[model samples]
Target: MAGSSFDNLPLEWIRAFEAAARMGSFTAAAVETGLTQSAISQRIGHLERRLGTRLFVRQARSIALTVEGDAWLPHVRTALESLRESSEALFGVARDRLTISASTSVIDLWITPRLDRLTQAIGGQITFRTMVLSTDAPHDDDTVRIRYGTGDWPQTYKQPLFSEVMAPVAAPALLHKDEAWQDLPRIAVSGPRPGWTEWCALTGTPTVPIPVLRFDTFASALAAARAGRGVLLASLPLCAADLSSGTLARIGDATLPHHATYWLIASKERLSRTQWGALSGALTLR
Candidate 1:
């Protein structure tokens, strides 16, 4: 037989082959596959015929792969896994578009409020996909990035939104009604400057050795503070909504300068029509 005719072997056939190989029993594969044992056997038979290979050796109670099947299973499995990952990423069900990387603090405390405002400011009706990565600098393909540093940004035109005024805030329930206001664990955010020391220096208050609970972002630290776990130092403007809503309370009036102000940064390329409108409207004095 110079050329044996075989029907078109679909992806389903290949998948069935892989599944049967992995499970080591056609009946078991059928059970996992939600197919009759005969159906699984038929798909594998069709596949082996098309490929002109002996994929498996059947026993009374189990199955064993031929040498070729054993050699090829890894490649087939790898290809299928790669396809699954890529498909999930492209479909948007498991991923997002227009990912905006920023500090967790910015996302939770600041952006959550003004996100609607920012979206409304943009011209088009495009909804953005956002994510938070723990990186100060933006890598390729990031549409917008926010950084907490002195306004000097590389390869970007920087706009200072507003200066942040720092304060030590906590749940009102934590502060004793009768005791003096000095005993609490300080939820210190990791940054260039120690907010507590700077705040104490500014207020001329006796700097006490307040125990520190370190956090990576203002958002997480704020949550801990709100739950009456400890006190957190944060910018009043960023935490304004929580403060006003009485979820968190201003423990004291001491304030300090943010080593870096909040900056809205974008790439130097001409802004898209939608982005131009969003940027202009967001920046406009209201």
Candidate 2:
């Protein structure tokens, strides 16, 4: 705000108004910024009084930016991003901060091993959090969420990660190539997800395998498979490492085309340009 006509304006007022406008709700702004809803309201009123114009049109269940707010939004957003960049340049990123919400299978099999690369790509000290979400779990807006399904999550932005092909993988010890594949023991999981039934149809293999065990999570099933317990249908990409390391072996050359997709999502509120740029590039499909 230096060297400007509005240099005397309080920075907090601008920050509060920016949050309220971007979140489209005073309550949501308060939740995101750790301010009280009443405080957000008061700050908006204070800012409007100083500017001598209404910035928000309050409604029963929603809030919309007025013409004045709409005009000022982009400038404020750019200024905030600039301020953050300048502060980082001077402070050298005091602490790394990021949080991700994803499924256990993705975390254990896919993202966990690649965390070092992600950190290196971001180029800074970082504290990362991973929340294990179920396939049908709701989105937690406070962190970047990974979803498994069609690219439709309400009130958020979606970025495709990678769709996974289904395949049968098990420990090499469990495979008996001379024996009939359908007669082998099959491990399964309990969820609203596809499994050996779908895989059998895709590969033209018989669905007459006997079930020996049923786990509740893919991680557990994978562990059992690696221990030479039984064959399990798993996502091809997620288990690629195990396949490469000779821990898990595919039953045959048959592979099913990908259907379920993995998507990275963020809430509707705008983020710092630098932060998004760093993460979005770091997460780009390899």
Candidate 3:
């Protein structure tokens, strides 16, 4: 058949054919397109007449796509997905709304602190969803993820956000200026983190096993630190505000490089350079 013949056919008929072939039944097509089964059947009949070929083999309780229909399914699906993505991309995805994802600690300490700057820079509203995640958490397509690890995650456009550093911090009242904090209580997170042993090793301090308090989560450990329970070997991003506010003061002069670094990872196909840069700058004043 000529290409002009396709143009002469109603788009409704082609849509009916695609739906019927995909669903494998005229009844299923009718349900999807919000039309009667008979209407769906008539449209598919019209399409086959225009194409001068049978697209499906009708059978009781089931319909099978012909070889040509099977070949065309992928193309139709691609077209629909492309149209949806283009419309969303050009029209600004609910009018410039951005959805981002991060750990509770990062969202609380790092991202939330700069949210006002982000909204002003992008000129759009930003929504944040948080989770307690490790570097091995599954990647999400709907939201940009800030993870902590080396910037080599598979199946993501990974950017190094910041090299993390950890220092021992505590309530100022717990320690005097010249007091030795080496024997003070130690707060540790039992998550996927290098613990006080690692910090002590990096900072050239001998490890002590006394008065060790363990928390299964970072939030609890941080809460303990704020309450003057003990000194916490905490990451800078996780306790940036506490450090800034002087609520938690570094107990010692030793700051050690962390094993896991913060990283921003997302699908490159879903973001443009301008969009990523705007977000990146808002998250980091540097």
On TM-score, the leading prediction is 2
Model 2, range 216-245, lDDT digits (tens) per residue?
A: 877888898899888888777777889999
Per-model C-alpha lDDT, please?
A: 0.70, 0.75, 0.76
Task: Specify the poorest-scoring 10-residue window by lDDT in model 1.
Answer: 91-100
Span of ten consecutive residues with least summed lDDT in model 2 = 268-277
For all predicted structures, in order, the TM-scores are 0.57, 0.63, 0.61
Q: Candidate 1 residues 154-210, lDDT tens each?
A: 544566656767888888888864666666666787765357777778777567756
* Clash counts for the predictions, in order: 0, 0, 0
Q: Which stretches of candidate 1 lie over 4 Å from their true place?
A: 1-97, 123-138, 270-274, 283-286
Off by over 4 Å in 3: 1-95, 135-141, 177-179
Error of 1 at 156 (Å): 4.3
Per-residue CA lDDT of candidate 3, range 1-286, in tens?
4587567568688788888877778998999789999999898888888777888888888889999878877887787667655765677443287777777777777777787887886787677877656646564545577776767665335676677877888988877646578877878887766778877778777688544788876777898989888888888767878888989888667777766777777765566555777777777674
